[model samples]
Target: MCERTVRFSEINEIKEFVSAACRCKFDIDVVSGRIVIDAKSILGMLSLNWNEELRVVYDEQDPHFENVLQKYMTS
Candidate 1:
């Protein structure tokens, strides 16, 4: 699996991020502490801890996935 730290500072970012995730072919999960939610679900994502860093985890390992991931990746 591939994982990256991410953050969404504004409401629009969450929408865009979830939209991007929905386009992905593989399963994507957002993990924060003990909670993990379906990345493609806007409602599931919104319930996460947006105030802190979270992980974007995916089962696929490819350059295309990496490119798509750039839209949500945080420092």
Candidate 2:
């Protein structure tokens, strides 16, 4: 499994990202004030509080999968 922090300035980009991420399941940690939820559903993504960064967890070594998520990666 690999993990990274990412930031999304636009919500529209999520659909493309989520679709490309189909190969591996992603556990997204959304932190909003006093709440934290492990999100995997697209609908749950909409509930995330937009910020400068969010953590994503994925378990797979597919080069293509990494490539697909590369743009969203931070450092």
Candidate 3:
């Protein structure tokens, strides 16, 4: 599994993230505090608090998805 922290500042970013996730064949999860949501679900991502950092967990490596994640990656 691979994990990374990301933050979305706008709704478009979430949409883009979800779009990228949908292209993947493996499972991807977005975690925040006690809440864990599917990365491919736009509604699930919208429900998260945008002010906080989110943890993205995925089972496999895909360069395309990783590239998308780069845009939102947090230090």
Candidate 4:
């Protein structure tokens, strides 16, 4: 698996992020501290309160997953 830190300072950013990843087949998870939620689930992501750095994880062997994740990583 691969991981990266991402910040979503606005609700719209989070929504768009989720929307893009949800279109893919792989699972995407957003983690804050000890809490983890499915990135594709709007309700699950919203429950996290949109106020923290998130750890995004995806299977390492999935090339498409890595490509999707690269878009969210800090430059």
Candidate 5:
């Protein structure tokens, strides 16, 4: 598994992130506080408090998704 910290600067970034996540067959989750949301679920992601930084957790790697993650990575 791998993890990264990411922060969305705009709603479109979230959409793009989710789009990339949807392409992966591996499990991906977005963690905020105590809430862990499916990365591919736009609604779940939208419900998150955007003011806080988020943690992305995934069990596998995909080069395309990694590129997308790099766009939003904060740490």
Candidate 6:
């Protein structure tokens, strides 16, 4: 598993990020305090209420996952 902090400050950023990421088969989770949602699902991401740093998690074994993750997350 891998983890990083990410910020999606605008709705358009979230939409574009998700759209670009939808092709890869991986788990994207948005977590704030005690709330967690599927990052791949726009509705699920919006349900978190936005405006918070997100913790992204992905399987470390994925070949292209790291490349895809770098587009949205920061160390």
Name the top lDDT candidate: 3
Q: Candidate 3 — which pairs collide? A: none
Per-residue error (Å), model 3, residue 53: 0.2
lDDT of 6 by residue, 48-74 (tens): 756767787656334455565566675
Model 4, total clashes: 0
Ranking of predictions according to lDDT: 3, 5, 1, 4, 6, 2
List ranges where model 2 is wrong by over 4 Å.
25-40
> Per-model C-alpha lDDT, please?
0.82, 0.62, 0.95, 0.74, 0.94, 0.68
Q: Please identify which of the two predictions, 1 or 2, would achieve the higher TM-score against the true structure.
A: 1
Question: What is the Cα-based lDDT of residue 65 in candidate 2?
Answer: 56
Supply the global lDDT for candidate 6: 0.68
TM per prediction? 0.83, 0.67, 0.97, 0.76, 0.96, 0.72
lDDT, model 6, position 38: 73
Model 2: per-residue Cα lDDT at residue 14: 64
lDDT (C-alpha) at residue 11 in model 3: 97
> How accurate locally is residue 44 in candidate 2, as Cα lDDT from 0 to 100?
66
lDDT of 3 by residue, 9-58 (tens): 99999999999999999999999999999999999999999668999999
Candidate 6 residue 48 C-alpha distance from true site, Å? 1.8
- Report the Cα RMSD per candidate: 1.9, 3.0, 0.6, 2.6, 0.7, 2.5
Question: Which scores higher on TM-score, 2 or 5?
Answer: 5
Which pairs in model 5 have colliding backbones?
Answer: none
Residue 42 lDDT in candidate 2: 66
Across residues 1-75, which tens digit of lDDT does each residue of candidate 2 receive? 667776677777666556566555544444445666454356766677655577766555656656756877778
**Better model by lDDT, 2 or 4?**
4
